[model samples]
Target: MDRITLKEQLEKYRTPYEEESAFIQDFIQLTEDPLAFNRERLAGHFTASSWIVNPDRTHTLLTLHKKLGRWLQLGGHADGNENLMEVALKEAEEESGLKNLRLVENSIFDLDKHIIPERPHVPEHFHYDVRFMIEADLTDKLVISNESVSLAWFTFDSVVDMIGYNPSILRMLEKTSKSEILL
Candidate 1:
């Protein structure tokens, strides 16, 4: 999406939250200089995702991203919806195929900033992400869709050890451990 298209979408989803506001303000500044925004950063990619903690809290589920080919939390494009919490919940359900999982309506995980790496087919842009923690029953029959190469549960310590994971994932780990975003 172009800067103008994304800006309009983001404006619709704008909430009272400071993080969301900060994202818009920064984006407006960035978009004013198209070449700088595209050359120096990512543009028009605002996403939300969920770090779903299983019932036992012994493990968290992750999707092995098909394109990125790394184990990561569930998330995707907002598609113009500004209710980031809803976007996260929708992604969790679509990616995991676990019907019992649900995002707590009133609570959300904190926002984290990351840059999209330059891809062969796409220019790099900044990712302004709003994350959340959703909960699910830990049954052995969890199914994953094609968006991921695989899905698995990992211990907290194991998650911390992942070498190439983005810092935002680590932040979610710390927050999830503290029960700041989960019930």
Candidate 2:
């Protein structure tokens, strides 16, 4: 999908009220076009993730990515699937091991693109991340998956104070706090 195609799709389905569709639309756009990432090499490598807000609304869960070692929300690459939301949900379940998760289908946020530093075989990279907000019951014990070094619940305020979270996480926390998605 070229920029024109992506922009047309964005304009077509992207609304302040629609969530999943808009995210997937943008994800498709970024994956199709390289310029959307603002960096030349990041054309096709796109991903999606979810910020699983707890029932209490006071805290949000974050995973310390084992490879990146940064406190971040649960998400990963799309692997060329058309079902981007499923990708986000799957990542959340895999990373957090929480079965009772619920995605707020209408509470999607903007797509964020960030650089993933070059590595041995992967060349310099960036991820055009489509992010969503989900409300899950704080109803079960969370088992951090191998992909994460540690898992912890941080209050919205604490999440803001956290040293390594990307700016989009803060935006997600702010957006979720204002929505009725929290149980």
lDDT of each: 0.68, 0.68
User: For residues 70-174, could you state the per-residue lDDT of candidate 2 as single tens digits?
Assistant: 898888876655355677889999888888888766433556656777767666676867667777776578998989889988878788677455666766766
What's the count of clashing pairs in each model shown? Answer: 4, 0
List, residue by residue over 64-176, the lDDT tens digit for candidate 1.
89988888898887765555677788888889887887664444455655667779967866776657778787774667888988988778789868635666677667766
Runs in model 1 deviating more than 4 A are 1-42, 162-165, 180-183
RMSD in order of candidates: 6.4, 5.7
TM-score of each: 0.71, 0.75
Candidate 1 weakest lDDT stretch, 10 residues: 33-42
- Give the worst 10-residue stretch by lDDT in candidate 2: 34-43
Alpha-carbon lDDT of model 1:
0.68
lDDT of 1 at 112: 53
Best-performing candidate as measured by TM-score? 2
CA shift at 97, candidate 2, in angstroms?
0.7
